[model samples]
Target: MPEIVYAYLDVNYWHPWKIFGSISSVKQLELCLPSSKEYPVGTVFHNLVYLMLCTCETEWLNLLLCLLRDSPKLKFLRFEQYHPIRPSEERPCWSEPSSVPECVVSSLETLEWVKYEGGEEEKEAVAFILRNARCLKKATISAASTDPVKKLEMLKELSFLSRCSGTCHLTFD
Candidate 1:
């Protein structure tokens, strides 16, 4: 089979079949499983490099962390929450885990997030990236708020990009 360069799956149709094996040479995979329970382990995508997950739930996030622990070739990572609508009266939490898989935070060269809600967990994740990902060349964070102060803070924290051999960019709208 040809090396799978990309794979996108909806959450409802996700199944633990040999699809991963069919793409043993895959270099990039993007999953949007809205209801995925667990990611299969030992399913080697030897040539896999880039990974993106969208509209993922908390459990899926856990599975992703586990996958990154094993996938060393991965270089680029992007995550975006897929909430259908902003809460009318309640604000939800957007915290990430205290510890992220070292393989991901340390190896990624580029990281991007859209609609990131600021929280302690999220802060820790960004901190991990800033501290461990020495090779990170660029980072982009987009949020729905247009507040200048909030935007400045994100930029300041991510200003560590200056230390990198490349540049980091942040945007808010």
Candidate 2:
């Protein structure tokens, strides 16, 4: 609906796009959903500025990039991991986009990643954002691991990566 501006969806058993796709006017949205086999590319969130996704067992980076490519005005992007990844679940992977998304180059400003584990795919996704988000102003990453050594290694790895935005402040916690 054109009148709808904010929506929070917690989907347990179904693909989220099927429901939210019809509402393109939303400005803020939060979603907690299971991983989907297919990530469609046509849903255009024309007015979306803030988006938060719960990173469950799924192709999260694929979905994030797809949304970023479509939501040209997106400014705030957040990823939250609410549950520990199971050993049996397939590890997620990231494939570089042929072209950077418009939002990352022109609009995205803030990125908050909670429960960052320094996983291969997670590092790739975070690294890609930092390198490409020209307008990014602030990025806060909170490590999920409790081990001091692991956290230090994760921080060291990410801190050396170059950022596109000169003024962007990156904080590791």
Candidate 3:
């Protein structure tokens, strides 16, 4: 069998049984969840630098966050969802407020969001990243409702990123 250095799995029948430890050399991984169950967590890609998750469930989001917290070498992350945010009265709480792992912001260079609908949670997510992610060189958000003016407003609200130059591009489709 050819050594699988990198793997990207969508909603397919392929079962994730075993990943080679040699695959620790894997640098990128993408996973899309077709159901609500948690993904296998035992397989560790030590060299993983890029990870993309397109999942609708909160569990998957939590799993991705946990992985990011554990993977010190992770540098890039892209998360997408197909559904609009459902309004809820209560805000979700993190387990550890103070110990919330700070992402390796200096190492991250790019962030991309596709089909995003700006909501309270989504806004909070972006704010958290912008506040902590200091080394991001490029950020792209593509969605139907994300107007250029709104994006500019968001940029203005980011007090931590006062040095960001160049106007962020916005496209409507």
Which candidate leads the pack in lDDT? 2
Local accuracy of candidate 3 as per-residue lDDT tens digits, 21-117: 3354667877764433444555555677887877454445465665666555677778777544345523333343344344545465566777655
Per-residue lDDT of candidate 2, residues 1-173 (tens digit): 78898998777766666775667789998877675555566778989999998787666776687778889999999999876667788877889999999999999999999999898999999999999999999999999999999999999999998999999999999
lDDT minimum window of 10 residues, candidate 1: 85-94
Best by TM-score: 2
lDDT of 1 by residue, 50-123 (tens): 87766335445455665566567777877777645334423223445566555555567777777765645455
Tell me the whole-model lDDT of each prediction, alpha carbons only: 0.60, 0.87, 0.55
Stretches of model 2 off by over 4 angstroms after superposition: none
Relative to the unseen true structure, what is the C-alpha lDDT of residue 87 in candidate 3, on a scale of 0 to 100? 56
Give Cα distance to truth, residue 78, candidate 2, Å.
Answer: 0.5
Whichever of 2 and 3 has more lDDT, that candidate is: 2
| Candidate numbers, best TM-score first, in rank order | 2, 1, 3
- Give residue 51's lDDT in candidate 2 (0 to 100): 95
Please give the lDDT score for candidate 3.
0.55
**Which scores greater on lDDT, model 1 or model 3?**
1
Model 1 local distance difference test score: 0.60
